[model samples]
Target: MSGNWTEQRIPDQRGRIAIVTGGNTGLGFETARMLAGHGATVVLAVRDVEKGRQAAARITGNTAVQLLDLTSLDSIRTAAADLRAAYPRIDLLINNAGVMYTPKLTTADGFELQFGTNHLGHFALTGLLLESLLPVPGSRVVTVSSTAHRINAAIHFDDLLWQRSYSRSGAYGQSKLANLMFTYELQRRLAYHGSTIAVAAHPGVSNTELARNLPGWMRMIVTGLAPLITQKAAIGALPTLRAATDPSILGGEFYGPDGWGEMRGYPKLVTSSAASHDQKIQQQLWAVSEELTGVTFPVK
Candidate 1:
């Protein structure tokens, strides 16, 4: 347990099986590479099989790929079934794929694009795959959230799907906030099980393609600030790597950069927004999620 955590500290991962969504590029690619390099059997659960294969080929250890488009429930179910049949046990499930600040749109299931892909997608996938992890000691579910969760974020129970109106940033914020709430609530449910745990991490302001949706003017601003504010993707993936492998991590803890405003630095145990810690909202969101996706957890 040090003040600064980096990829070098990732414990030996031999014999482990890790599934990282969006593993083909950016932060996800970096995460998959490190895990595979450490001897873990890494599955690049990406939407593009060709890209996944290309990414896997670049890595040095055992690796595989499964097509999963988080925007579609059918895709999630199929991918989950395929993964379950392929691996009897899952040591780690990294819900790292997400869309950010896209124009007002909905997923194949008709949920808001960001909410559907970021929160509900991971939610359903985790529920379907929980059985494989529950029996495996030290198993972890690490969801990648974002610092944007604190900006203009609210659960919007009455308008969870963003049917009324849409602000791309607000929607993205809600999704990221849901990511944290889901982690905390999931950890609570798994506490009695004693084998599986849920944790969350954010990459801070990393230079990644996840920001491609930024508006033209905003992109310019970001590009101008990049030198001073953003870190590389490899560095951005550290918090997630730590959250996934740090043996000292407990259920419900969040990790992020240790620098000012958590923008860029080595990984460290970090706190999320106070709103993300709301128990009632978390439970409510969970119920709504299950009702919407029809995917219930194996745990109580």
Candidate 2:
């Protein structure tokens, strides 16, 4: 497809079911709104029920709210169970929620906060919900990664939890990189079945709450440059929307902004870091994720 893909190009989604994590605000909210407006029954899977409901109300079409705390495994499982019971089949699962530049901290599962919520949480959620997707044709799993993955990122296998030392950017990069690795690995695993596909996307630099934890100096710089460098959540969501709905999009493909530095513009096919395409590393990350989350994909 050309670099002009927009939400207007999104195909009709009348009976499709889509679940978007962190759909209450920012990119996720815009994504859900667009999809719901186009006829899909959208579910806002978020940490806050009231916010999700408010978000749902603002959407024009069919929408629902589901409480999902990505940092908690118990909550993930419960949400998955509830969703399974509510919808026997799903057409789209968009893993769009994430944290950025967070202070040193851990999740309820005792993992680095960024890696835990951004990668592992989505990892486990997808695994548990795979069965519902596997039986449906044209089903898709779209993971939202970031350009940050290209910034001094490594899996840190020796100390996956960053037990040794932690740099906020490094940890955030690791998680984003994991998001890409997970997409590639999942697509490879799903290839034989030919029923579902995994694709990835990045919002570029968008004005969102994800950066609330950035250091003071960095935050000020971002704020000052926001108008020229950053796009709104609607624009930032195009790549993900394209990845989720575009019929031409293939598994393992990535989409992002089409502007300079990929910081803003329309959605277009994009490339990721060479390190992110390392098959060996991808497999290793997959194994480690399965081990960490104790949730295995049904494909393999």
- Computed on alpha carbons, the lDDT of every model, listed in order, comes to 0.94, 0.95
What tens digits encode model 1's per-residue C-alpha lDDT throughout 1-300? Answer: 545677778999999999999999999999999999888999999999999999999999999999999999999999999999999999999999999999999999999999999999999999999999999999999999999999786798878888999889999999999999999999999998977999999999999999899999999999999999999999999999999999989999999998999999988889988899899999999999999999999888
Error of 1 at 295 (Å): 0.2
Q: What does each candidate score in C-alpha RMSD?
A: 0.9, 0.9
Give residue 73's error in model 2 in angstroms.
Answer: 0.5
- Per-candidate TM-scores read 0.99, 0.99
Off by over 4 Å in 1: 1-3
- lDDT, residue 3, candidate 1: 50
lDDT of 2 by residue, 162-274 (tens): 88999899999999999999999999999998669999999999999998999999999999999999999999999999999988889999999999999999999999999
Candidate achieving the largest lDDT: 2
Give residue 75's error in model 2 in angstroms.
Answer: 0.5
| Over 4 Å off, model 2 | 1-3
